[model samples]
Target: MANPMKIRAAVKDGVTEVKVLMSHEMETGQRKDSSGNLVPAHFITELTVVWNGKTVLDAQFGPAVSKNPYLAFKFKGGAKGDKVVVTWKDNKGDSRTDEAAIA
Candidate 1:
């Protein structure tokens, strides 16, 4: 299993701001190992964010993204104590889901 992602969500003036830090190697195939072998591309390909059961953000990523990606976003219509969920799927079929309450 991959490491748990760090997430923070806060609502202010009816807008919710979210920040996430995901832990992953995010290797690109273009890189090489010490033995001069190509590293397989391993990266998050899809990510989704939901608030109160409604989808707020849906995104796609590629190997170009840096390791341990950090994401920040804002959306309308969230309140304190609302549930915010985040899920990500990597190219290797590994997926992780986490949730937090709006503060």
Candidate 2:
């Protein structure tokens, strides 16, 4: 299993902002190892964020994204103490989900 994601969410002035940091190797398959062997592609393909049980953001990522990706976005209609969930799935069928309480 991968490491747990770091999530931060806060609501201010009726807007909720969320930030996430994911841990992954994100190999592009084109990179060569020290042994001169190509690395297999390993990257997140799908990501979803939900605020209080409602979908807020959905994204698709590719190998081009850097490792340990950081994502931040803002949405409307969230309050303090609301639940924010983030989930991501990689090309290798690996997935992770984390949640944060809006402050």
**5-31, model 1: which lDDT tens digit per residue?**
899999889889999999989998899
- Model 2 residue runs over 4 Å out of place are none
lDDT of 2 by residue, 4-61 (tens): 9999998889989999999999999999999999989999999999987799999999
| lDDT of each candidate versus the true structure | 0.93, 0.93
- Candidate 2: the clashing residue pairs are none
Indicate the residue-level lDDT of 80 in model 1.
88
Tell me the RMSD of model 1 versus the true structure: 0.6
